[model samples]
Target: MKRCFTALIALTGAALPSASGQGHSALVQLQAHHSQADLEHMEEHAHYRYVGELLFYSSSFLVEEGGVERAATEQEVLGIDLHAHDGLRMVDQRIAVHDPLIDKHIILLSRNEFGALVLERLSPLDRDAFLANKRATMEQPSSKTQ
Candidate 1:
């Protein structure tokens, strides 16, 4: 894993999780990655490219289609109608939330029971907890950007 600081976005050459529905093994093995502290520092510098990766660990998404609730890849969920509320089951990220505001979704790089990287969405509460972990990890950031 490598991350380059551009004008805004960090070119984090990262991708989806493993097939086993686990977390990002690449990121975890890397010496340096885009931690929440790095993102926060970038924000202080006003670098607001795509904040989605910052929420990588946040379970910020949920998908249940055709009365079948299963974890799906981002590609599999792409381009599905989300507003269908009736017998129509669809996939979407910008689902309505209790805050009366469109909830922005993010890809959560989590791990399944097999220790493989899996892509999923974190709940709001989980997202908050992830941020807290990020805040804690930022106290001693790593510089091994290899």
Candidate 2:
């Protein structure tokens, strides 16, 4: 009985999904193309979802929420921005209506008390790809062990 239980546990553990493993390779490929400045800019903004060429930022603000009643101080707003110049050409404008997670990021862009862009989320795939490529490039062959 103990042997059977152990086997079942092992099988279950093996079958469980690993969210990090599936998409990381593709993400690594994607990151190779971006520059450090581009990454820093994205990081400064709020969490964003990558849908094709656009990054959408969404946040709940203090504003009226419903009708007939007094406008609530809080409201939710979605903001969209174009990330790539090539991708921008495909869209009608540089900015558009915020659409929720069509890709990866969930938080989207967030604003401060003064209404300035403060945080942004990168797609996990994008991050993984970027870091992996960087690691690979930084690896060097050495003739002597130190």
Residue 90 lDDT in candidate 2: 22
Best by TM-score: 1
Candidate 2 segments whose C-alpha is farther than 4 A from its true place:
1-16, 49-146
Instruction: Tell me the tens digit of each residue's lDDT in model 2 across 31-112.
Output: 4545555543443431121211121212211122232212111112122122321232222222222224222122222223
The 10 consecutive residues of candidate 2 with the worst lDDT sum are 69-78
Report the lDDT tens digits of candidate 1 across residue range 92-142. 323322211222232222223111111123334434554555566677576
Whole-model lDDT values for every prediction: 0.31, 0.27
Separately for all candidates shown, the number of backbone clashes (residues 3 or more apart, or on different chains) is 17, 21
Q: Can you give the lDDT of residue 38 in candidate 1?
A: 56
When summed lDDT is taken over every stretch of 10 residues in candidate 1, the lowest stretch is 110-119
> How does model 2 score by TM-score?
0.22
Q: Against the hidden true structure, what lDDT does model 1 obtain? A: 0.31
Judged by lDDT, which candidate is best?
1
Runs in model 1 lying further than 4 Å from the true structure: 1-59, 77-146
